[model samples]
Target chain A: MNKPSVFDDFYSVIPAGGIGSRLWPLSRADAPKFLHDLTGSGKTLLRDTWDRLVPLSGVDRIMVVTGRAHRAAVEEQLPDLLDPNVVLESEPKDSSAAIGLAAAILLRREPNVIVGSFAADHVIKDMRGFRRAVAEGVAAARAGYIATIGITPTDPAIGFGYIQCGDPLSIAGAPNAVTVRSFVEKPDLETAERYLAGGDHLWNGGMFIAKADVLLEQLGKAEPALLAGLTELAEAWDTPRRGAVVDRVWPGLTKVAIDYTVAEPAAAAGKLVVIPGDFDWDDVGDFASIAKLHSGGRKSDLAILGENARVLADASTGVVISQSGRLISLIGVTDIVVVDTPDALLVTTTANAQRVKSVVDALKLSGRDDVL
Target chain B: MNKPSVFDDFYSVIPAGGIGSRLWPLSRADAPKFLHDLTGSGKTLLRDTWDRLVPLSGVDRIMVVTGRAHRAAVEEQLPDLLDPNVVLESEPKDSSAAIGLAAAILLRREPNVIVGSFAADHVIKDMRGFRRAVAEGVAAARAGYIATIGITPTDPAIGFGYIQCGDPLSIAGAPNAVTVRSFVEKPDLETAERYLAGGDHLWNGGMFIAKADVLLEQLGKAEPALLAGLTELAEAWDTPRRGAVVDRVWPGLTKVAIDYTVAEPAAAAGKLVVIPGDFDWDDVGDFASIAKLHSGGRKSDLAILGENARVLADASTGVVISQSGRLISLIGVTDIVVVDTPDALLVTTTANAQRVKSVVDALKLSGRDDVL
Candidate 1:
């Protein structure tokens, strides 16, 4: 099940989008979550994700699907990416159209090829475990199933969706893979605790692998109009008509997530399988989660992000500082997050970090784009 | 007894020293608290204090004692100040020398003139009440007793000294004036509560009035060396030898407060009186006090100290923002103070606002003068 041969036919398709409004003042629309290095590492999340998948899929085998606004940034960040391999959607039509368009484009190039879609903003610390999980998923995909890599629940986190394992799949290299019974939405604390205690549920990390034709077949079964539009754009993708085709077709595509349009429906039809991932994973969703990641799994302490930050904390704990080269002093303040930028500052307690999205909404309502 | 006649002979001396370290980032060493409008008013604290006293003391009768570095700013802020009235100290030598030099300089011209010393940064909200109190203090001064304006206790605050009042003085035009029994240092909460419970105690506002010759005579009795240095400087004050005499003698003068060198000793000699001030007053010593002032005497709420600041708050109370024309977002944080400047920002709770001075001290220790 852990054989390296499973990675031979795998291709990586990264769906890079999402402004991550919950991490606002640090994550803006122009420079989003994927473009930022939230883990204090020198590399951005997109680049880190690219580096992680490069071993399995070489530079030419990896494709990135992003909005037209971010196409330049993606190309600038990943220099080796070929122009044809960079799928630029004219506008955002949700994850379903983005991934379906990438699949359709890849199917036009090579039929029956296995394409794995991973988000660009997620952080994967355990590379070996991630590769093993992806290999298992790819093997399951080859066995004619839409396979998803689900993270083993380390904590009863209510912020993520869950996948329930029904029965074990009998794929050759994916002996640990199981048939997904149901895909549940983000649960409450009680349901999350029950899922953790049951041990049959895993956090859906939103990673999926399937044959390009199989994914298009699922999209065609679910949303025929979206599938037809993606197919038409794919037909003109490498031709001189790509710009006109994308501009005409992208706006009419149904704006829905793949999880709702395909995964849930496919799971009802016994077409979805789950491969359990044992690696550390985070989407870097909010400042509180970021504080936890920066603390290196510590209970309560300071989490600093930049190099020029000089912090003096006294009688304070759980202070997350995304510094802007300024000296910050925290005294007697606990469980607070301070994101200091050149133009804007966000100060809040960990309890209210999730409400930061509404702040962005308010800013948009007021037309404050200078900070937005 | 609160006649307008006592104000005609009264001269005002404003000792503008202390850098106000507790309100750092807004009140810097270069631009101290007196120069800032902490109340969101258009005028600075010094200008407000000057305007409040203009009815009692004409612009020509007011004298300002400030550090040599602040001389230019003080002159620019108060253009009506005559050249000889601007007493510029080469270095800070505390309140005793600053006030004593002012008294000696005034004594050289008019020996029997009553002089009042008020800090440049203190806020007086009720001008009529303040003027009445100053007039009563001037009457007590004419009656041959050094008089101090003591505020009616609004709260049991431990940050200020308490004045003990004895029998009421039977002097003309000063019916509310009482002989001062003693001046106690800043008390603990229990002692402050006890003092508040007793109606005989008043909060010392650090405002004093006495005849120019009487203050000089008291200084001569307490610290002869300081008095001698001040007298020699005063004799050379209007002459060409002023610079030479000041350079030789100013540094050797004892650095002490007027309360210790003159008021306490004068009270022990039964030559001091206290005139109760029935007005709203605050020293604006720390951020918590500033927050209270900015709240306009309300219980607990958000207080903003700048016009250009744009704030977004959610489920928060007791927040104070001194903005630097930047947008600040606060979520689910209570009792916090945020002072945002162009170069530095300070975020702390109301309870720990007094600890800001230590933060400035730490900044100085780390050689962060750019932020300090």
Candidate 2:
């Protein structure tokens, strides 16, 4: 009853960046959201991502693209990852540069390798459904389409982008694959409800799968200078000039998201396909979402995170992230969010969770770099 | 012409106790509310009380009755206090014992010294009004009346007991003194509103002025064994047997508040009068009161307390007591109460501030003595 591995030539490029300011005091600039075990699953989000990809791409074929500041932490979290596959950027040039460089480097070794770009801080519970979607995406990628795994819409969420699915594709081993008509921005509530009820749209979770050579070709077609710089850096990646080349070229590269530079342009040109993923997934965007994730199947509405967190909640419902070794007590406040760290503390409600970014912005404006 | 110091024989006794559980994390069992500067006035409440009393009663005539645990802190906060003026209880025996012991000891020193007992944790802004009220109260006390200062109610507050002023007294130099009709417990909203409109009800702020012998005689009439035990301990207070006498008798004294054991009974016997105090006063019963105190003239509604606290609040209103030297950030929350200490943190709201005692109770039930 052993299932055969179907992604031998697939490489998972994990783009680990973004400070997740909405989950502040837990996710900081130096220690981004990827490093913390936010889901109370006994593993960090990045580590969970590695474990998920290992079953499909194996450890050696997975490449981690992160800032140079997080290189030591990513290596420490993923010790089994190959040192040669760790791609460090001098500074963030957005997803286009991070993912494009990974595709260019992998294409230099294997021209037709299927590269899957997954964010390092997402949460996926169903491994079976994830593996199935990735299998279908890899199949579509082999047929010359830039494939993406679109999450089936479960709610009228105004926080995420939407992908409109067109006619079904006839690629082999990819029965669920469909041509992507377009990628839309996050909509208003009324528009999101219409998209949810219409059943023609899926949430774009920023997961893309494509053949390495095809991805580089698309990037060259869209932004020639970005692709040329990435190709030159990829050529010197294996040599001792990686540090010097990355430092010189990363800051100069055009900053853009993969959705804008690659997915949207390819979809408009009729060169994109999407495989629907019907699994439970979350970006852990705010404390409210984290509260919902940890309160699953539990009678209590209180969600307490951190290994040594000492929390005593009474008649209260919310999320408490206790990174400091202090006792957190909540009483008679519903939908509250309390994040306790050694150097800073955040108190707001679930309704105000998304507004936590304004607090971080105020701190930066006040020149409180110590806490930031 | 220079204004002379009034009431040369007046003695001030400050009863400094109570953990103030409703202000948890900021107020703890080890460091009670009197030890903290809950208002941003650059002085602890106990120190403010000491400074307020020094003009009427010289530093040598001011006595502080606190628990054995807070002896060092109380002494350090009031350095000019005489060594023999401190009355340390092994455990809390309530306000009756604390104030009665100070009265009995003063009675042994001077038979008819006018003793004024004021709680150490109250806030009074108008020192001139307070001095006028105390002078009138001292005059009534000299005329053989157990006088209490009753604050003129500015609002229908249900957090404090109400004192009903009866007929006006015609004593010389005590025009504001009136006979107390009765002392009532904290009332419901409707009753509080009724009292506020009645024009005769005042907040009983637990301030009492009486001759030392008169207070002891009233205590002896109300509870004879309690007065006898206090008298025995007071006889040995200045001797080496002071420790032995206190250890033998203090624990056995009847536990009762000064209002219940003396004020109410003295009013019933027609021996009590009240002096109308037209000054801003607050017991600081909860975070809501503290917020109002600190945000008096500020345009912003947010009230931040603590010397080294670094806070960045945006679109938030309420109180933040940050004693842990941590950066506290709040966003888009209204009426919130955040108490950040070294070992514990409490997150609630001004609407739920009174219920914070339940949090402390839950912590006690969970055996979190380290935080308690």
TM-score (C-alpha, index-matched) for candidate 1? 0.94
TM-score of each: 0.94, 0.94
- Candidate 1, residues A211-323, lDDT tens digits: the string is 98888899789899888998998999989998888778888889999998779888988999999999999877888888888888786778877657767666676655545
Candidate 1: C-alpha lDDT:
0.86
Error of model 1, residue A233, in angstroms: 1.2
Candidate 1: chain B TM-score equals 0.95
For residue B64, model 1's alpha carbon misses the true position, in angstroms, by: 0.8
Model 1, C-alpha of B362: deviation from truth (Å): 1.4
* Reference contacts preserved by each model: 0.74, 0.89
Minimum summed lDDT over a 10-residue window in model 2 chain B is located at B1-10
> What does candidate 2's lDDT look like per residue over B43-137, in tens digits?
99999999998887878889999999999999999999898898899999999899999999998898879899999999998999999999998
